[model samples]
Target: MERSWTQPVGVGVVTALVGFTSSFAVVLAGLQAVGADTAQAASGLAVLCVLQGAGTIWLSQRHRTPLTLAWSTPGAALLVAAAGLQIGWSAAVGAFVVTGALLAITGLWPWLGRTVARIPAPLAQAMLAGVLLTLCLQPITALTVSPLLVAPVIVVWLGLQRLAPRWSTPAAFLLALALIVGDAVLSGQGVTLLAPVVSLTVPTVTWTAVVGIAIPLYVVTMASQNVPGVAVMSAAGYAVPWRESLLLTGLGTMAGAGAGAHAVNLAAISAALPASAEAHPDPRRRWIASTTAGVTYLLLAPLAATLTALVAGAPPGVIESVAGLALLGTLAACLAAATADPGERLPAVAAFLVAASGVSALGIGAAFWALLAGLAVRTVLRPRDPRAAEKPRSGRHARV
Candidate 1:
């Protein structure tokens, strides 16, 4: 049966939009948090989009599978929460470079990948959940500043999430957009367009950025984004080569960081969109949707500056609120994943609390400390008797 182009093209466009509107604000805010000027921030967005799109296209073609590439959303949140106002942007860029290099190593070396896999998943997820805790407060905080503007956006987001789950994020983004632009137009102060300009920055490596940003960014990108992204494709029955895909994204991340961008990685939520039956009935043909989505990303590249300008022009409260709303679903999912095991609850909770504390020492962010603290507590609290492991099996046999 010959496949029609309609589904592939339509799904591709939708997938592109989902990738863009969902986390673009987080990217911008992350860049700004690290001390990016408007030009640098816009350039980072442009470079990130291009690299993600290019990487997706290349990987999908090379592997003959539907592969979706994306920037690390959780990593962006890490930046927002941990971009030590003192470390400055150059050091952040250096951290980004280090992260990319680490990602590449994970792909190239089987031992490294296995070692990363050994990191207790519960602790990793708990750390991510804690990192996101503060940003999740934005919507509520925004209400105190401008309820009239924020209330409607939140209502629409919540309403659509139940009514049309897939469209909820885009709808929320649109509502926020309307409010931001509408206010500008009505007040006789029209929104102005700013052309994105690329400005190269030589990254300055520091112990602070290496410990505080690079390590955590690499961890979250791997655990929170790449791991689930692979699962999404595997669930859809696409035999993806995880190592090669990681290598491509890691290289792309390196290129992107050269232009002030952060990590590029595998798509998690959006991956299934292009790989699903909706994209194409025949799995082999689904690559068309991913490639088309890549083209759409390239097309949208020029608008990165405008998007940054829009975000910059909006009130801080509104921007934070929108970002918060965007991440609510992710936070819930992370929390659930972190606590999935009954036995790991204590360690996970400890990680969560420490991460949520937002403490930094000698420039290292709280997320790292949280993981360390959780592991230490888990070790101390664990049963030292070797026979403890046999008790569970014995109980099961007795029941049988």
Candidate 2:
């Protein structure tokens, strides 16, 4: 499973692309959601994208697994709710610092890592299934909105998947882009490109943004993003250094604080795609994908403006759909995993429901809540079921 250089670059490009805007777009939306001025939001985004990409690239390589890194997407979605609140930039940076520090501390704590390691694999797998289900459903359902626009793309994607499995999505994406452009030219309706925003407002340190925004950012990114991101790596055959990864995330967030970014943590689903059978079947050579992505990121860090603007201009539905669709395979894998055995079925369903419910009672995300609830149910029901022992016996037959 040793990856060659070419493998990393190719996989990295695919990974880099998802970040190109999906990361920035939602962050910008978050800033607006919280009522930060255009400049402040953009600055924060700049810090976020750069640090996130760098963190991802670095760890993804070090782990030699399909370690995808991403800023907290749901965090942005959360921001949409917080928009119109008056939060100062300094406070926001402070929150980032706090979150980073917490991550570092937790990562270094062997107890926490060991506890996480104890979660049954099927339960962990179900968590992924829940997220991917929601993500993929978003895009597939898009066809109802514009079948003409979306159907052909999906049809081709399906055909390509069966006929040329590896190239399916990318090929479909390129083909869709070409057709969209061709229609624009032939119909004499060129798409309007917006000017890239390049605001540079300095953040004034404040306590409010820290308490209100920063803490939540840190909480969700680690609990939501980092947890599952690591799961994908482990599933793909990498023996990860949990503490080291935590240090990288902490450092990444620190870098963001200086640069005016939000949160940067491991990527879960999309990064897994390149690492999965979809991108490359060989393992040894896959680290190249993250390496390639890192190089692409370092080269483009300077062009943050152009990149953000382009994504900003693109239809919101497009990117959301893209993410949702890209996650379809992962979602299917998860769904099948959740109910593989009779004993874990109910608790796994609880995990899925809680995660999908999107409830955040104490600054933590539903994913965390789901796991907790499911675990509680499982613990309560464990002694009663002779079938429960079926799980422990599983490790003997665990896959590489």
Candidate 3:
């Protein structure tokens, strides 16, 4: 009996550890990129942690499935890419709210979910790749700018990637944390710990933000996180409660939006950690693993302010290096998916280039334009249907 409980509990702990440590830097950077000051970013991180934990616990308990929820990592990456849009913090919060509303709508209306699904895979993947491009290149840039501070972290990451692939990013992030602490001590600016506080902002919706932020955020979160989450659960032989999951995540996203959190959705990659055989051989009990993970996230919420403060003090490029390393695998996967189909390559490439260019026109960001450009190129390059030119047969004597 002890073994049964311990095994799943261990897996749950690891799930939360890996999930949080591996990508928290990226989350922080993304929040900061989108006009959030350090305090606001901390609040965002804290609220996200709380919501993720709460949602995971509620879903797993209600459904008796290892259903885990996570903050929208790709949506955060989208925010990072849209940094140049100059949408103020309040507008960004408004966008988050709009994204949440859309998610709720998708859950309530099946056709909306179908429409989001119909966004061609290659185009969505290409757009994600383009957004990730600049962030993924940060490690290289950091190396050039501060090799002494960055190289050791990269070495540790590479070494662990070979030895224990799953822990590589976390290991690098830990090393970066050490560096940040050491620097703080050496500079005579002792690290200060503060209670995590949620700083609320009254969101101001704008047309530019809605076009530039909300729509793309919704698309990326749905495509990269929510849809894949369902597939992951399906692969694990569990039918996810899709509508309920969406409603919960949508509510969670909106609840935290005013506190700087971007969006929350079903976990994609990390969902497997709790749902898989690794969590429990008897799949019926795997919900415990998710419950443990949710509790862990709640415990970690209080540290968000401290972590954000430490990261805020770290030398330029150090923390970014960690975030960049964290995203490299995601970047690689997106690229592979974007270029997988021969027929879609040209259009995907077009979308990829436009998004990576960081160009904005008419106060709209590149991600939205990337989709449009890809569709336009695809339409132009598509081969004509032979049936269109053939005369229709109308009677019993016709071909039909």
Clash number for every model?
Answer: 0, 19, 0
> What's the TM-score of each model vs. the native?
0.95, 0.65, 0.96
lDDT (tens digit, per residue) of candidate 2 on 129-242: 554455556566776775666776677778877897556666555555566565556777665543434454344545555544555455456545777776777787765667
How high is the CA lDDT of each candidate model?
A: 0.85, 0.60, 0.91
Q: Model 3 compared with the native: what TM-score?
A: 0.96
Query: What is candidate 1's lDDT per residue for 1-400, written digit by digit as tens?
Result: 4355778878989999988987888888888887788888899989988988888888877776889899899999988878554688888899999999889989899787777777788889999989898889988988999888888888988998889977777788888888899988988778877766676788888998988889989999999899899899889998778788888888888877868879999999999999999999888789989988888888878898888887888855777787888899899998997787766778889999999998989778898899999889877866667677446531221111
Q: What is the descending TM-score order?
A: 3, 1, 2
- Give candidate 3 misplaced runs (Cα > 4 Å): 386-400
TM-score computed on alpha carbons, candidate 2 = 0.65
